[model samples]
Target: MKMRDISESQRQFALLGGIFAAALVVSLIMGWILFPSLAYARKAQPINYNPPLHVEQIGITCDTCHFFYEDGSWAGIPTLETCVDCHSDIIGASPEEEKFVNEYVKKNREVKWALYVKQPECVSFSHSSHVRMAKIACETCHGPQGHSDPKDYLANRITNYSYVVYDPRVPLNAFTIIRDKGETVWGTMRMDECTACHRSRGTSTACFICHK
Candidate 1:
């Protein structure tokens, strides 16, 4: 080809490339801005809670709602004494509260809290894990519960939850994970739910990260 013609062709190609690149960058910017809002429309899998924890009223005292005992041992159960202290006062408050107190507490049995909050049976997820080791706040994933009104607690059903983990040896159903209040009973076991914070915050996860 002639030199002049070759130069013209090269210029045309460069112009086209620049235009393409500009369009690509604009598309990416638009996507980044819009994607998250669209994502909220997508149902969060694995952990599904209903009523969506709105109340701070499940009793904010660490010892009140949480089964973690003062002795550093998980009571894993709330006994009648725990209920009587407040239920005695809450008798006329509401039928639900009274039933929980008068009926269940009077039975000398604890409320059968459907524990959707769980990790793999093989994996020991201590509250101390994030609190002590990683130094991450609980609300990073659990959201704000201390301020959540008890009445607005998202009521979740204690149905089966498929447990997934880093280790294949870990039992799939090792632990029955409890969804927060208002979480759906049947949701997908998503790997992202577990890995989300780790990835976002650049936390290092070894096998001992969750599984011992």
Candidate 2:
């Protein structure tokens, strides 16, 4: 009777251990699959602007829409007047174009575009220095925006900051290293990435160059 009771207890313990291990495996798999989507809120663009299509038709460059001002400050988002210059009249019969004309152009309101690149308040970036002095192509940092299709923009809901999503064209091998190091890597711009690029180009390494 004593031997039977001991065997029964051992069997129960083994069963419980197996169940716990299985639950842990399932939890890990679920976390791995769902974490990325949960971390980001993939919001669709308010205006369906096909960048690649516009680049082909308009013959306008990226700088045409996003250019540095006379004061050497970057105009991150273009104003409504910029669009009205070419889109005042119904340039295309598309629904998006009609919506733009009626809602924004006629009303003389700027399209509230969600800015993708946002640095912290302490960081100061000069587009004039990078573009004019460094002579960097817009595509180098921003990727081939002219050749890519318009897709949903990603942002962190908690921080209300923009983040960089995985791009097939640009491999994010650094992300793998970040994950391996057990660090919380967001889709946003990382200091390491910026430093790496600067090192490659032999740019200024001074802390004051980027930090305010």
Please provide TM-scores, in order, for all candidate models, with all chains considered together.
0.46, 0.81
User: Each candidate's root-mean-square deviation in Å?
Assistant: 13.3, 4.8
lDDT of 2 by residue, 83-192 (tens): 78788877768898898888889888888876666777888888888889988877656655666654556666676555433244432233342462212222345688
Q: Weakest 10 consecutive residues, lDDT, candidate 1? A: 42-51
Query: What range of 10 consecutive residues in model 2 has the weakest lDDT sum?
Result: 177-186
Q: Which residues of candidate 2, in runs, are more than 4 Å off?
A: 1-6, 161-187
Over 74-121, each residue of candidate 1 has an lDDT whose tens digit, in order, gives: 654355676466655444444566666556666666554433244446
Q: What's each prediction's clash count?
A: 26, 1
lDDT by candidate, in order shown: 0.45, 0.69
lDDT of 1: 0.45
